[model samples]
Target chain A: MLKDFVKNIGYDDPLEIYLSKLEKLLGSEYGISKRAVSLLLLQEDEEIFELVKKNEGDKIGVISAIIREANSHYSNPLSYIISERRQGEASRITNSVMSVKEKGLFNFKETLSRLMMNPFIGGPILLAVMYYGLYKFVGNFGAGVLVDFIEKRIFDAHINPFMVDLVNRYLPYELLRDLLAGQYGIITLGARYAFAIILPIVATFFFAFAIIEDTGYLPRLAMLIDQLFKKIGLSGRAVIPLVLGLGCSTMATMVTRTLPTKRERIIATLLLSLAIPCSAQMGVILALLQNKPLGLLIWLGVIIGVFLFVGYLASKIMPGELPSFYMEIPPLRLPQLSNILRKTGSRLKWYLFEVLPLFIFASVLIWLGQITGVFGFLVKALEHPVRWIGLPAQSSVAFLFGFFRRDYGAAGLYDLKTAGLLSGNQLVVACVTLTLFLPCVAQLLMNIKERGIGVGIIMSTFILFFSFSVGYFVNLVLILSGINL
Target chain B: MRKIAIVGSPNVGKSVIFNNLTGTYADVSNYPGTTVEVYRGKCKIGGEEFEVIDTPGMYSLLPISEEEKVGRSILLAESPCVILHVVDAKNLARMLMMTLQLLEAGMPVILVLNIFDEAEGLGIDIDLDKLAKELNIPAVKTVGTTGAGMDILRGKIEEHVKRFC
Candidate 1:
């Protein structure tokens, strides 16, 4: 058996003597070797120490004394001393077997990798990537082109009409027919949004995200952004979850578990919920603002301002140790097409399964509320705020849809746009408010699950008021300035 | 049936190797920290069934982040029959330290030099036999993406299981 001749990583003579002495006292029943337990004890691993204490009664004091003695022998911690010795042995073995052939010149990947992390060069590169990958590809092609084809040519022209006609002819009960295919029906609204609007947008976003992921560009981007993140009380490592939030905030909220500090996790979660609109909502917003470049820029400016301003305030409010950043910069490589497609396919499958049912469920709930007249009352209540923000009363319906899902609300706005209900100014304001609106039901559950219920509720409440307040202000500014946009 | 657990630093193709061995897919990406949870699948090796575990990436026995803690917990608690210490071939020296720690723990370890093609592209040549002897364990070269060297890896796993398990 391999354990018979376990490779003994040699430490200093005193440390080795201490290790053997500690090893003599440890219980033999541990899953790992006694020597490893002793080594972990010497390194002051609290969990291992507790485990040893639990098993080896009466020997705890002796182990503690020996660890202290070992500590006295070294200025550095025993963990560093042990790891350094292990590294030395590793280097020795690696040197004995590995050879590097020197190249002449022009290491293109190395050069490009450096450029990617360089502060002066990295910003523009990041912008260009966003412009092309997100704006041009996901926004224009996915939301604009693909969404138009699916929503207009397929769902609106073919499926919705056919389903409504079928329901009208076959179903005797008006309520049942309305639930199936009438206004705010499951097939007409929910299935249409899921299949026609969200599908293409999320699929394209995941494809672009997968390609970016496989190219090993994220770490470099992280390093470049670390300084800015530090100011916001997050390490460069937080970039992973924050970036993932763009695809889906629910998953990204779960991914925050990877962060080292609770402070960082909470901050990251708050930002994801409030500012980082998921791909589906973002796609709709981009499409809404596609013809108005100035409006798009203003929307971008306000959301970014809110992101930084809120982050800075949160950092100041929370008391914790500042996060330190460290991440591995894997070498840049060409992404394999097969792998990219597989990843995109799996992500799309996951997104659809997670979202499709919710969309349909939201429709059923809305239909129920309508039959009971509760939906009209809620929309009427919402109309007050909707009008205060200078939006038409019809916009209240979209605001109500916003609670089910951010993208659902945006999809409502899209319907409004197609109906020629909203003006340019109203469109931008609606987009901004919806983008900063409450996280969806799934993300809310995730927030409570990841962070405790208290923090999750508090965050949601703050976001609920802040979003509308910001909308009100944006609308006020637009009216006062008389920009008409 | 015995168990085979694969552990490594993030993005070293542990999931890829796990998929190859188990004939199932786990999320494999170039970026680190994707596999934040454990993945388990069944595999048949040399007429023997094995439970193969794909763990979150960890740097060393001493864990810092939450995922690393999960990785270490699986190793120290589950006690698999064969521990595949997967490492990136391009960064052998830095990664091999964890291999040494795994060995010191007296776990049954097989060093996997994954991403072997990329290392070769960078003009780094590894003497695999010497690496095996130097570490006093079987070492396998693998391109996890393409499943190269997988047969030899399976052979090595079968040999280890027959001898130890």
Candidate 2:
């Protein structure tokens, strides 16, 4: 057997003494070796510390004394010293067992990786990536082109009509028929939204994301954004969840589990809910504002400003240690085509499974509200704030739809735009408020699940109020200043 | 079933190796830190059926993030027959710390020096026999994405499991 083959890594004398002391004191069988647990305790790993405290009821005082003694002996933090020793051992082993030939030509991949992190070069590259990857491709091609083909040529011409006719013919009772196939019915609106408007946009975004992920540029981009993130009290490590928020805030909210501190997780979740629009919302917003340069610029400015401003305020108000960033940068490589396709396929599979059920549920809920006359009442109530933001009374319908899902609301606005109802300034204001509005039902549930009901409810309430106030303020400033786009 | 759990730092091809051994996909990508959850599948290697778990990436035994906790829980609970500590061969030094930790924990660990193609391209030649003897554990070189040396890795796992478990 290999039982006696365990490598014995000797730590410095003082730490080693504590490790032995802790190992002797440990009576309850931890699943791992007591040696590993003892090392973890020396590193001040909080969970292990608590576990040891729980397991060793009376021996804690001696363990604390030993830890303090070890701490006093080290000039640096114990973790730093321990990690350095481990690294030294690792490199020593590597040197003994590996040989290298001088293949020291310039690694173009390495150089390109640096160029991506360099501020002057990275800034333009980021813009080009955003403009092409997000705006032009997802906006023009997915939302504009593919959505028209699916929504108009396919759904409008065939599926919706067939469903409506089938409902009319089969169901004698009007209410039952309307619930499944009427104006806001599950078949008519929910399925259409999922397949026609949202699918094309989401698939395109995932395709772009897969390629970006394959190239290993995210961590380098993280390095570039680290400074700005520092100002917002987040380390560059928050970049992963925050950037993933662009794809889907619901998933990103869950991804915030990777954040180190509770403060960072809450702050990241708040920012994701308030500032980051999910892919469908992003695609629709791009399709709406891409042609209108001034309006699109204003929209961009508003969202970024809100993201930074709110993050800063939240960090200042909530007390925690400022975040520290440390992440390994994977080297850049040309993305493998097969890997890209497989990753995209898997992610797309996940996105559809998560979002589709929610879309259908939203439609059924809307139908219930409409038949019960609550939808009319809610939209009527929302119209006051809608008009206050310089939007027409009809815009309240879109705003109400936003409470269910952001992209659905944005799609409603897209319909309004095609009807030539909203002016440019009004369009900007509507976009700003909708982008900042409450998280979709799925995200709200995720927030509740992760952060608990009290925090989730409080967060959504604060977001609802702040988004409108900003919309009102932006509209007022633009109107009073006579800025025309 | 006797289990073989694959673990390493993020983006080091744990999922790829898992796929090669299990014939199932676990969402491989070039970016670091994408595997946020655990994935499991079944594999038949060396005439033995083993349950294989692909865990979320972890840096060290002292877990700082939730994903690391998820990865560590399986190690402490399931007590896998062989811990395949997959490391990117190019960054072998940086990754060896976790392998060292796993070994010190008295777990049965087989070092998977993965991405050998990239290491070879960088002119780094690893003497697998020497490395294995130095570390006092079995080591295999693999390019997980392409299944290079996967059979050797599997054979090593079955050998370790049969010997220890």
Candidate 3:
């Protein structure tokens, strides 16, 4: 049956010649059919060649002879030859078996897919997606509405006051009670920031992300941005991690492994950690600049400029050949509402579970630090640098919290914003600095786990210095240019 | 016990098929590269038990990335009894290249045309028998998300192992 099938296909003669030589050398010990194995061996299949060489050491001469003979038969490598044959056969079979009726209706989905890939129309669509999906929906609805409800109505009105009073009453030590209830208290501050502020923003971002992802819009976005990415030595595939970075940079760092080259991965990781503001940071920045469109644009411009400049610089510094990018574009489909909801729910649950314990632990640690007066000392130390950046000394705590989590610092900024401690220029500078600051503790640990401790620490240190330096420069530039908001 | 390795390019529903066969939850997503790690489970078929291995996606045998290296290593090391080469039906031309590579590797391959419903919706009509004959292997169409053609796949697996093993 196999021989008959092989004969009908009509590419059996050369394969047969190769197989006969292989079979004669190995005899009964060769378990695989000689023809199939020879094709792989000729293709420089290292694993198969190694096994055959190990088992039939004496027959290496004959096998090499057959490989040379096969090589002489094709100008291209044997792998290409074999693949072409197989593809030809596949297409032949497909043609024989399948018949198409009249062409179906013009698909709007395909047209939309094409439109999304066009640089002209697609650029605006991309901005629209970011503006509405991210700015209007996630920023305003999530951070403004949901966060306000949870942070103010729920935490401040109910949880914080109750926890502060309960702690003050039960704890005998004034210091310990103050640690649990006073400023930077575990329940009153840390837990409230995590659950009430960060959770709502991340949840909304993931929901929006799920919808966009399911609609197959991301790959189209990738295609649209490929030219821009080429300048940075990345391909459309890098877009996956970059987009996800907007949701969570730690996850994006891990996803960088999918990039075809190590250089691409490193560059991608650097950009993600340094420039791409995760959803929490983005939300807070949006809220901070909600009333100042010019400030928001400036903030956006600085981050984007840094992303491109640094990416371009890194690509030049990193020595490697650029990887060619080709991705299969899956047909666009209407995202099923149920699937989007399920994805959002599951991701939210996962995010909450992963973050809640960390937040609680952060609170307890802060409480201990406060009792030991370490928190006060660190805040005092940070105050000078905060003032140097032109931010008020009150911004010191936010910078410290920024080390724990970027979003934590943004939550601190939210508090400061509410208290009216920052002007328009100060808010812009602060946002840019925090956006470029060190990765959160969780991301640091994740980076160490994924990329090693040395690399992670180096990246973090680089980011810390770079962020403040950029902040200082931006402040200088603003003053020098005499741009007043 | 025998072993069956589920292998395919990224996001072709390999994990879903693995979950369907093994009764396990491995995070399924529309995005690729979700299954960065290998997963193993057991299933009973035709009064015999088998070990099922799920691997990361690879576009070709000649690997370019780390994940593909992991996938290719699994194929080389395990020498699975039956290699299930899962391909998206809508992408028959592109995916068949991998199927061809598997067959060339001299592994006992079962070609799984997954996402058949999507192909049908696109008005693609595949002649399964013709394809099977041309490749000299069993070809099965499956809508893995909905458990369609699963029984036929299992039955083919049993039949192949009985005849070949």
Candidate 4:
């Protein structure tokens, strides 16, 4: 019944003629209808071709000849013609059974949805969303308020002193005592950062992300940004992973697989590695430049500049087909509180499980580095770049912490800021450099996993030099221009 | 156990429907491309157990992206006892293209008009029985988020599976 009806619905001219001929020729059972098989074969589906070749044997030659003849009948590809026919039939059928009531041409949600995709309006709406959702909520409330409450009121005032006292009094061995209570102790630095700095910031970011995600705003953002993205050799579809990269680049790297082409995937991965700072780092940077509006502006400008500059260069250097964009924009819906909370909870769980160990492990490694003098040596080596970037010698420790995770390094800078070690210019330069720094260890491994080991290493190496160079240039510009924040 | 596979374009609430059927959370989101892996859980239809598989989203039979490849492979390899072609009701005209492809493939398909609430809110009304008769398949309306119309969907799934498998 289905095949007979579909055949009657039919494509124009020779395609319909070719389909019947191929249907008769494809003798083997393909688990699907012969008509469907014929259409696929005509469209030159690689998988279906191999299947038909295995099943049809010598008869494939005749089928190929028929396909060639059909192609001659149409200027467009057979797949396009066939798909158009299917779309026409679908619409015809839908019109028969589905009806729409007369109403105001643009409903509230529909108008908002349209405005969300308009270039001028959408861009400003996006900034407002980022300003309120990210800067105010995540940065001010999460990183500034909640972090201060946890890091200072709880961890610094209470937990660290309690832990150090407990460890110092009970621990017998001098080396063990220092390892547990010293500068880079797991409880002192690692656990503190995980719970105090990273936790609040990530939670707030995820909450904001979940709300925006549920509102169906991201796809509209994708549509709005498509023209810009096409210039970078990525389609609007790349927005999903890029936006997600703000939440966490490691997960975003995995999401890049969703991009249609390998070239798009590689470019997206490289951008995520080099430019997109995860929520933790972004929040901390926001907190660092909270009072210094111009410093924050400079940091924002530099990061966006690097994102576009690197993406443009990569798209040019890498040889591949330019990406095409097609995305389904789901209707805008009110953010469901349950869904938002559950999403945030699940993501936070994933972050805690994936990242907490790394934070503590980094602390242990730092402790080891200190004991073995390797940490001191690395910090010393990093100090030269730190000087070049116009940051303090102590800032080298933050840069080293950055290698573990971008957020951890930002957290290190937060400590330095609290201690009043860095000037406004140094804070801006460090934030700019650290934001563009190599992705965290989790993302590093994820990049290697998603891209091959070779590409991942190349990307990391490129980002390493690029971030520092950008930092050096920013510092030089601030000096040369004689404009200090 | 026989299997029921939920397939659709991305972000059409396939995972939410799967969650509704299996009573398991599959990370439902408003955006597309969330379900990167196949999720399977158990449910009972007509007093007989069935494995419900939630696949990554696919637009058509011909695969393009990695997610679509995974989805297309599930259809080819698993040979599900019943295929629920879950579609967003609001964009039925566009989404029905995939439904036609699935039907043309000669698989046992139930056209699920998911997100029906949204469609109705958009002042759209679909004649379910007429649509079913036109396509020569059973049709059901469902609001995947609130689990509305799920009982009817479950009834249809049982009927489709019992008749086919």
* Candidate closest to the true structure, highest TM-score: 1
Q: Residues A272-319, candidate 1: write the lDDT tens digits.
A: 999999999999999889889999999999999999999999999997
Give me the runs in candidate 2 sitting further than 4 Å from their true place.
A12-14
Report the lDDT tens digits of candidate 4 across residue range A14-53: 7778888998898877767788888888888888899899
Ranking by DockQ: 1, 2, 4, 3
What are the per-residue Cα lDDT tens digits for candidate 3 across A1-485?
Answer: 12321222335577656656665666433444456566667787776688788888788877888888878887888777766777787676667766555557998888998999998999899989988999999989998899999988999899988988888788988877766777877677867888898888888898898888867787788888888899888888899889989988887788787888878888888899899999888988888888788998999999999999999999998868876878767677666676567667877777777777777677777777776889889999999888888999999999988887888898899999999999889999999999999988878887787777887888889998899999998888988999775
Model 3 chain A poorest 10 in a row by lDDT: A1-10
Query: Candidate 3: where are CA atoms >4 Å away?
Result: A1-41, A45-74, A175-180, A452-454, B1-4, B19-34, B39-52, B79-82, B106-108, B133-137, B145-147, B151-165
In candidate 1, which residue ranges exceed 4 Å CA deviation? none
Alpha carbon lDDT of residue B86, candidate 3? 93
- lDDT ranking, high to low: 1, 4, 2, 3
DockQ score for candidate 2: 0.71
What is the Cα-based lDDT of residue A351 in candidate 1?
85
Pairs that clash in candidate 4: none
TM-score, prediction 2: 0.95
lDDT of candidate 4 at residue A89, scale 0 to 100: 94
Winner on lDDT between 3 and 4 is 4
DockQ for all models, in order? 0.75, 0.71, 0.37, 0.58
lDDT by residue (A1-485, candidate 2, tens digit) is: 22455687898777888789888988886778888888887888888778789988989888888778878888998889888988999999999988999987988888889899998999999999998998888989998899999999999999999988999998999988877788778888778878898889999998898788778888888899999999998988888889889998998898888888999989999999999999999988887886788898888899999999999999999978988788889878778888878877877888779778877788777778887889889989999989888899998988888988899899889889989998889889999999999989889999999999998999999999999999999999899999986
CAPRI quality level assigned to candidate 2 from its DockQ score: medium
- Using TM-score as the measure, name the better of candidate 1 and candidate 3: 1
* Local distance difference test, candidate 4: 0.89
